[model samples]
Target: NGASRFGRLRQTLAGVSEKMLTQTLRTLERDGLVRRTVYPEVPPHVEYELTALGQTLREPLKALTEWSVVHIEEVITARGEYDDRAERTR
Candidate 1:
């Protein structure tokens, strides 16, 4: 939610490859949606946090998540019907 290390973010988002995560983080940072901080230390520590603009997405993202959860079955069913129609045409 707040500041988090790469390892913690990777762990929280299961099944994401390091390369993908790194790329995504870089893109977000580039887009000004996330802030990356590097601390000079023995091994160098880095942390990522949502920028003010990113924080503004919280409610909209949450609403999208809820909508997906509620409409997943319908979406799946529609996909199946579409696939069947496509196959028939083929």
Candidate 2:
């Protein structure tokens, strides 16, 4: 999903600390992957979007998301089996 802003991107990519995410974004921007925009307002506002190279990631990212959603059951089942096998051997 295309976010309206950088804050939105941070929120969407869960479990990332704000500071680390900020630095990561800066690096990506430096690498010419993400575009950052600043809007003048009383407090100021910022937005982040993908550059052409970044946009190319959309399809694979979406596919990965779909795979996680569709194969969640298999993932869980495999995890349980692994844990059980480990416990028996222990």
Candidate 3:
């Protein structure tokens, strides 16, 4: 909903390694999809927030999530069919 510090993001995204998260954040920042802000303090503070361009993806991503939930069974069935055909050719 707003800016998120690294620790907060790491907590929210379970199983994501710090290195991977840092890389992903850097990539997003480079792509203009996210903004990174560093604050001067005793220990230094940093936060990441989505850019306007990134915010535009919220609806589309949500739609995709909904679609996947609805069609997951079909996707699994298609994968099984493809695997069966491949096994027949071997």
Candidate 4:
């Protein structure tokens, strides 16, 4: 589907609260990166989708996400080494 509800997005992100998700979505929509559509129904149904500009950013973001996943261990190890060096200097 081109659009997704707040709950779906929250679940997809895992551990994101309703308020945080709402704020993030609102920010994205306000910045012209996301489109929010509200449907008139028995209960108001809202959906969010990436705008064209947002779509353009997907690939690079995905690549960055993948890189982080791959390098997380190395990053953690480097941090520990740096911390140890700093402690030794003190």
Better of 1 and 4 by TM-score: 1
- Model 4 Cα displacement at 86 (Å)? 7.2
Q: Against the unseen true structure, what C-alpha lDDT does each candidate score?
A: 0.98, 0.87, 0.98, 0.92
- Over 1-90, each residue of candidate 4 has an lDDT whose tens digit, in order, gives 388998889889998888888899999999999999999997899999999988988899999999999999999999999999999999
* Native-to-model Cα distance after best TM-score fit, residue 90 in candidate 3, in Å: 5.7
Alpha-carbon runs more than 4 Å astray in model 1 = none
Lowest lDDT sum, 10 consecutive residues, model 4, at: 1-10
Q: Where does candidate 3 stray beyond 4 Å?
A: 83-90
Point out the higher-scoring one by lDDT: 1 or 4: 1
lDDT of 3: 0.98
Clashing pairs in 3: none
Residue-by-residue lDDT tens digits, candidate 1, 1-90: 899999999999999999999999999999999999999997989999999999999999999999999999999999999999999999
The sequence of per-residue lDDT tens digits that candidate 2 reaches over residues 1-90 is 454676677778899999999999899899988988888996789878789999998899899999999999999999999999999998
Per-candidate TM-score against the hidden true structure: 0.89, 0.68, 0.81, 0.84
Better of 3 and 4 by lDDT: 3
In terms of TM-score, which candidate is stronger, 2 or 3?
Answer: 3
- The TM-score obtained by model 2 is 0.68
- Residue 30 C-alpha lDDT in model 2: 98
Model with the higher TM-score, candidate 2 or 4: 4
Colliding pairs, model 2: none
